[model samples]
Target: MPESTYPRTALQRGGVPVPPLALGSWNTWDRMSKDEAVALIRRATELDAGFFDIAYYNMGPHAENSRTDILFGEALRASGVDRDGITLCGKLWLWDWPNQGFRQQLVESLGRAGLERFDTVVVGDYGKVPDMPRLVAEVNALISEGLVDSWGINNWQIAHTTQALDEAETQGVVAPVVAQLKYGIARRSMAEGEAYGALFDAGVLTLQASDVFEGGILATGRQPERKVGADVGGIREQIAAIYPEVARVAAGFGVTPAALGIAFCLSNPATANVLFGASRLAQLEQNHAALELALAHGPEVRAALAGCWVDRDVRADGVW
Candidate 1:
């Protein structure tokens, strides 16, 4: 399928357009070598997956060495695609949620990406509610200065999102147009149950990550080695047992496990874009297949997958 034929969704802020599916470089690029990471990014772009999400403080103590954004910039230059054809997205780390820190982080992200501007920059999870006001202010400053094309928050609850929007409106700044969250088959309640209704009512778009393979559970079909504690391990095993069923459903539709996993997220009407993490070129190719499959399914297939949601509590720390 042609790149233009792929499903496109527009965000509420700046009416900026992004593909329904985006290539994410969170844990994938964090663990891979620079050369491998760059090749996978270029391959994703070659396959017409133009949206890429890179986080600055992903690798914990070695955060300084976390050059995913820089590698992505190099890949983009190598791909020979015009900057306008790509949508680059990044986040402000939790540490940068303080006064004017978000703006400073935006400048750093732009410098790493080697771009004059970014399509979207999300304020990663705020550790405190009070910081929301300052973060909103910083985002507005960046947007007003043309340093950021659009701004939003990630993992914020309904009340916080509403508060931010109200604050932005009071200051005569653009309210956030997108909410980044983990929304998938087993993880629908937090996003799709109540919070999603509130966001929809308030006219906020959603950019969903971890749509599949949360904590490497779906991809490995085994308990994630990185997960700690006994309770989390038990929950991981339970979720792992259900992977075969997920794979079976995908087989019925002639798709891969990853494709079925992503399709489950694309089924949601509120989802403006689906974000996926790929560690290698092969994984990027597989995710590209999911994007095409989603486009082919259209409305009916999405409706069917939406009905197949299973309730489970999958937390960032571990399985809840």
Candidate 2:
């Protein structure tokens, strides 16, 4: 395996340092055994990729009241990894916001994971437009209360995210430092498009690239068995239609489609971290090649992928 040459990025405003890659435990934890989970964590720490995106799934369509949080907590303790050496990024869903509230949600999530605090928490998807002032105030309160070091947004509307930045500024408090969005070779509009791109360019927000492989469809060149992200503007079929082109390009770079997808996200100047999931150690090791690919062939990778999904200019939507 190649050495990890990807440099750390200091997220805007919060100054939270993150590696170019993070391990996301979305549809991953429950599938692995305790030993597998412990080994994955140990290996991630050794590779300087200890950051984790964990959440208690109890909201939206994907919600199944999973105990993956508890499982991860057990694995962490059993792995004997140093707590201070890793970063934990949790999520607070907004499906029942104002009623459920950030405080209660954060407490429950922390309790479930047996963790003291999350290094950062992403304020997650909402059913409708949210009250920006209240949201900002609560997020700032969490920071002051030492519950979370920093916060970010997930799959929010362009205007809503901008309003969050403004509300934080008006309150004279810490603004959100990152925006996690569906960014990958198969989908590029929301993150790379004009709206969020401007925020990134202006240094008001950093990009946390998510769904980089389109739920493994882009990487495998086949439809996944499980449900994936919504097909906004009906772009999934179009993305599938172009898989051969994507594969050809990846082959030209002597990399897998997965590596190409991850490299595409890391090549962007605004990207703070790219979140990917691995159910096995081999998968985790293979994905790390993306950093080297990004370092050595970033420009060419970006240029090669620039023409893909050009028609996917739809707004960010769905139960993310």
Candidate 3:
């Protein structure tokens, strides 16, 4: 809790400590060369930011047949970074839930990653409401089987997240310790709003800040021709329009907009860690400064970007 210390805490119920940032594998991670991936992995570990949120990316809108998981496995093996030295958080897509089954997804994802187990698995992205009891039981079964050490919810509604925790607690099973949501300078409502904030405040859950850059749009201060994550509240344009203000504020802090956006998320007391995607080693190195930024001028940065906290109506409904 010291000002100089980058917060490291157990993301799992009784698991090893994780750092303040996690590298995400979603869009551009698959495009990295093996050597680049290896170097990035090494540099991330060197920075003590070795936690990873890896996924197979072969379901729903992500069914582009990406080999990001496979590539990461290859890079890890070549990087020679000890597997035990890093924490891996995989994803279990609820897109095709009961039919595909968590077990099959777990097996296939681990196989793709060339790993035997994930330290944590996030059950995410469902079209409809899933059976809470069944989901909780399956996650518990995975824990017992040692396929995953722990589990958490991703983009889940506040009510459903509470139900999952209640079910697990009532059944005398392990419950989630973190809630991964789209949270950043532009997207703050879900993670900081009354419902989810209560969970974090009451010591029931910690926030995992994801999409801090809105898939590079917020970082670049310009919208790409390609698509991005859910435009919840139809506010992507509003978010884009506010980029100049973000850049202006970043200029005052003597940091890049991307670094300030990242630091803003890390500055929040409720955020246990922030997930960021970088395609280059330089980008990774630049982002490492965010920890110091968060430590030194966190409150001032938060207050500066107060105007960019748009999309207050956004909630964790498990859709995006």
Positional deviation of residue 78's Cα in model 1 after best superposition, in angstroms: 2.8
Model 3 Cα lDDT, one tens digit per residue, 1-320: 11224768777545577878789988656767888999998888877578888898888877777888898888988998888888899999888888889999999999988999998999987888898899999989999999998888888888899999999998999998889999999988888888888888887888899889986778887776665677777888888889999889888888888889889998878888899888898887778778888889999999999888888655544334
Model 2 lDDT, residue 260, Cα: 87
Taking all chains together, each candidate's TM-score versus the true structure is 0.84, 0.94, 0.95
lDDT of 2 by residue, 201-227 (tens): 999889999988877877888887875
Lowest summed lDDT across 10 adjacent residues in model 1 is found at: 227-236
Top-scoring candidate (TM-score): 3
Model 1, runs deviating above 4 Å: 30-38, 58-65, 225-235, 296-320
Could you list the CA RMSD of all candidates, in the order they appear? 4.0, 2.4, 2.5
- The predicted structure with the larger lDDT, 1 or 2, is 2
lDDT of 2 at 153: 95
